[model samples]
Target: MINNMNKFIAIVGSNSNKSTNRELLKYMKHHFQSQAEIELVEIKGLPIFKKSADKFVPQEAKDIAKKIEASDGVIIATPEYDHSIPAILSSALAWLSYGIHPLLDKPVMITGASYGSLGSSRAQSQLRQILDSPELKARIMPSSEFLLGHSLQAFDDNGDLKDKVAAQQLDGLFKDFLQFVNIFNQLNNAKEINVQKAKDFSWDKD
Candidate 1:
């Protein structure tokens, strides 16, 4: 059985301001806090990504990578801009691609909200394509796709998620994500152990 006694989860939102996306993330955080150690990673402080700065990525980006690497799973809540994920989110993903690739073989889930009628469905769909690339090394959950419509009205002025149905759905998503992470961690640990054993059992060994 997989032991999730110390699993760490990271939550990221695209917008830098008081965004509904952040509220969704916070809601997930609250849901998982009792079951796992949670860390909130804000992408707002990250500088715009540039390929020329590869050798020395900004500290904010570097910090985000480390957190992703250390966590067992990642949850992203993105906001739709013009029917697509925000450029800031894309930039952050681009920056992450150059590093050690902490997302490889990890469990990830994406959700979003929009002020328009369609919610962030288009943006979430586009994000799934970007995340599906081989470089990400993550398993995307297919059971549910969360897209909040009229997001500005869904949440209160304090940025709290006021919709009970959305809150419950977010809770369910985190629970499933935790289960996925536990299984993934178990397999990863087993592989590490086998690799170590193989290294120690070389034919040249006594």
Candidate 2:
């Protein structure tokens, strides 16, 4: 019964105002409130990362990156479009990956909802591979897949999940993710401290 108020940001991958994926993210954000301060985000405000080399990135994209960097962990909730993530989310990831790895060694959780029978499993898989690339190297949570299939009927009018099983799964996923993030952050912080100490060590003869 540990209580840790970690800050987290949820990224929604859809541009549609009526997207079920967005609603799914909202529900997950509320469910994680007890364990974290979760803020749901969207990529609609971010512009395409690159048109030409060394072009100025928009302030909106920078703002989103800042929020992600400030947070303890990240949750990416998206909708599968043609067996892949949507363009909006892709663009947002591009912005985050520009010139540097925004997710380097950062804790990341990925989930998605879709109308199809497999939900967004394919999309999440693709996202996982992308996050695991040497360039990004995000510490992704494993074995806790939160894929909500048949999402059109997965929620009630109030946007809360209707399936008790799904709710339970999400609860467990959130808890596990929180623990994972905490452990990783602790280790990363310790490493940073050691590195700082090493940098300040005196090798000169006084």
lDDT for each residue of candidate 1 in 38-77, tens digit (9 for 90 to 100): 6678887778877563345787777888888777677788
* CA lDDT of each prediction against the hidden true structure: 0.71, 0.80
Give the alpha carbon lDDT tens digit for every residue of 1-206 in model 2.
32357888888888888888888888877766666888888888777656455646677877887888888889998789999988888887766765445577779999899998898998999999888764456789998779999999999988799999989988888889989997887678544444344335332424
Global CA lDDT of candidate 2, please?
Answer: 0.80
Give the poorly placed runs of model 2, Cα more than 4 Å off: 1-4, 189-206
Model 1 residue 85 lDDT score = 89
Candidate 2 weakest lDDT stretch, 10 residues: 196-205
Q: Pick the candidate with the highest TM-score.
A: 2
Global lDDT of model 1? 0.71
